[model samples]
Target: MTSPEGGGPGTPAPLAPLPPSAPLPASAASDLVLPRYGAGALSDVVPSALAALGVEGEHDLLGLPPSDRYVVMLVDGLGWHLLHRHAEDAPFLTGEGRIRRSLTVGAPSTTSTSLASLGTGLPPGRHGIVGYTMAIPGTDRLLNTLRWDTTVEPLVWQPHQTAFERGVQAGVAVTTVSRKAFRGSGITVAGLRGGEFVPADSAGQATAGTVEASRRGDRSLVYLYEGDLDWTGHRAGVNSPAWRHQLSALDHFAARLRSALPADVVLLVTGDHGMLDVAPDRRVDVDSAPQLRAGVRMVGGDPRLRYLYTHEGAAGDVVATWRERLGDGALVLGRDEAIATGWFGEVEDRVRPRIGDVVIAALDETAVECRRDFPMEPLMVGWHGSLTAEEMLVPLVVAD
Candidate 1:
């Protein structure tokens, strides 16, 4: 029972706990199980954003007062904690009223699930974008949805219509402002399809596009995204100066958009997911641990959160072994237990296969790494894809 590569083996040492001001857990909020926006929990938020743009829905959460314009600035990987930590860096965003809240971005907390949830206004269960990489069920090959390197046709694989499409159908002028290169990417096809695409190569360009989109009136919904913050956070630790620099840039971007948009426009800002800093020494490469790999088939997921698809009859043993090995650093649960606990939010029949037989959720920055395969220099430092408040709970900052 020697220590693992990055951190020592057995029970992992606890890092600084999340801030006391963090949002309460979903279970604490209500006794009745709420469908995740798409699977149905507090999904009204999507309609609320739509309502602000004049999209007629029985469930509108925006509650905008006759305003004909709306802008949803989705900062990639901008978690509430990260934002709160650098409030001064994000002066424009912090100066506004704080609507601090968190939303689950599905298991694995990768870009695919979070982006799909954001675009479709549905949980991963309904939308089917489950993880960073998933073996197309019944097949041995893994599909990378973000890069769209898969056998199935992108549209056919993920057929759910995006909220953007619904908004367009409801006569709201909908536009997606993002990196010019992603104008028609597979990820966009699966989740963010239906809206007019506005190509923007820089944060300033994106901010300008959002402002212009809102100014057009006649009920407009603009989706603006920034990717550098998440990129920096992943390669560099969340606390690193690089991450802070990105936050400062985000502040400037928010301010520019805030000043440029019409006063009547309701600007809502949120993120796909948060991040955690994984210690280089604590990383445990499953590739080298024979016992850990015993019954596991394909390992899919990012570092912080993992999905272990075990051999047909070995799930129980795998779970027991992992739980015994990792202790409190990771929570090992069976597929049924995970669903019963509402981690995936009312699992639909179609989504069940997408989940792993055994789910491993890292409770802290400590991640289950595959060292033999993954390098150290560029190893993931700020990792995510877990259920912790830092990874699962994102903010919903609104400005009038």
Candidate 2:
């Protein structure tokens, strides 16, 4: 395995020139427009895609053509900016004939929420995986979606049926190609339900599985995942050569798949979220920042964006303090304000508790790290889970 970018785990990236600051619009609540397909929220995109792929029902995101196979290669953490930056390494992607921009996952754009959203065709509000680790409503214990370690059963915790399941019920052959270990994992059960799981431990195996699915030439939906780029970026900054090498590997994999699949098959490549290099010097340890930690009960989500649950009656004070301290680097909003802003797309009744009493969205290239609690390795180097363009925006490249 390749070593990560920035120094060790918690070491932040060298600070780059800060981007222009843009606060989340005060009217964000009423103007909730789902990114990308713009049907509604992130949840609406997948179903729209399935519908376009000719899958019956309102839940299919890609509308597949009859007798045509559909392949969706979700490259974990391969942000649009990262792809454009490392175009040289991803020749097949950059040189592709047609590539379009896709919407970033919702606020605190982490893998868990985004993946759940894509898999279920529901927004974080519906799926209820809002952040990295969030408190289960009415319960003190936190729920870890990535690991699926929780008191609640994984299936019941996120009970929303997936687009894959709906497709299978509609007689569409559905398949998921990912690491062999994920075949029976809780995360897989919760997100990728109803799909025939194909174990692909290596890039070669992943490509082979995808090609084989496409060759079937029936109404098939093949979901493939490549996680190395995100892994490299998390360990090393996105600028690291190791990350670039991973991009090259993805490019080769794409080229190989394209060569193997029939021209009529449609292959859509996208990502869960983007990443930002947070330098060690810039890391604002929430534990150290009294103003940030004031009245906070728990800190969930990733470093770039965090969910701060304040003690009873301290919500207003906590929001004010965070806004004052983070200034233009982040947008601090009260719970009602966040929900009204429609940031999480129609905030469901059950999902309300998943959000923090005060939500913090990082704007510029800044991140809020918890030096005291989070594992040191994840705290360092490349961090994401924000609403910035770099982290929110992804690409939609199609190969026919």
Candidate 3:
């Protein structure tokens, strides 16, 4: 190895140190278990806290010590790996809540799926809100589960009782403080229905309202959400100036919450997924790529992970074409393979059909995109919805 330029794959190449924005090399990296839903995951946070507060439920594998009150704050797209990369930007995070460990978000690592997991204390397989967009079975059209069509009832589609409902049933005071518009959204009705709805338009208001809610009862739970950080990342990539500015804003918000919350009240800050900035050239346009569309009936999920429903008897060709075309930068799998891999974490019988016959998951900076059908998505730079550590591993940064 020394004779060959004195270097090998294990040797550190002498070059300018790569910045956080630099894309990582493609190679099979170390592996981690599927998001441990019942053990350590976004899904476990509330239940763990509930167990800490003496609620009746599955024992907490996380062992949170103990706390009387909790304010669960979820910042959209705040992946654990992303936080470490830009830790300097968030002083409060790097200072008080900073730690080496992280918790996994549910599969696809998208908002709706993970939120359902968090709220219901179950994985995607059991709760059944599996992706950002899932096909309404027996229909050609894919239902944007977030926006959601009016015909479907949220409670009926996802019939599992949420943790909030359980908390309320146990006579625990539960309040949900979120965007004014989110009170009755499909996401709200399905997973976050039992808690008292408190609308807050600004971070200041949300934090302040949660503080008040904490003081109201001996046994209380308050859930808070911040979307601006995720919004900025989606619009201008996680590496963009806009996203950094938003990170600073999040730091200030975290500081405010830290200063205001009662000592007994613990704040658990987490995110649904992390994001990656996909270069324009790296984006594979399925609409324009004929091979990608050869046997595909429709496409769903998003840029990082694609759900390719196929025509009758075309799953084999489609999978081969996608893999051959996309090459090393992607993980192309059939329905059975995706489920068996536990990427979706125990796919349910009813929800199984919603998954694409062929799934294309970008392994590195590669993204599968569409310009013809979804015009806005193509323009966005930051993307998520995959199993990569950058997207699945999120912080459970705790503030006592």
TM-score of each predicted structure versus truth: 0.86, 0.87, 0.91
Could you give candidate 2's per-residue lDDT for residues 1-400 as a string of tens digits? 2112223344433323234444546643322223443343345545655676576656444333333577888888988888898788888887756465465577558888887887888777777778887877886667777776746777887898898888787777788888987876767888777868888998778878888876653577788888888988888889888888888988898888888887777787888888878766556667653455668888777777688877899999988776666666776788888777666777788888888888877766677776666767344589888777788877777777
Kindly state the number of residue pairs that clash in model 1. 16
- Please tell me which model should have the higher TM-score, number 2 or number 3: 3
Output the worst ten-in-a-row residue range by lDDT, candidate 2: 1-10
The per-model lDDT (C-alpha) reads 0.72, 0.73, 0.80
Error of 1 at 71 (Å): 0.9
lDDT of 1: 0.72
Superposition error at 252 for model 3 (Å)? 1.0
Off by over 4 Å in 2: 1-45, 59-67, 377-379
Question: Which residue pairs in model 3 clash with each other?
Answer: none
lDDT of 1 at 327: 57
Best by TM-score: 3
Which runs in model 3 stand beyond 4 Å of their true positions? 1-33, 96-100
Worst-scoring 10-residue span by lDDT in model 1: 13-22
Each model's total of backbone clashes: 16, 35, 0
TM-score of 2: 0.87
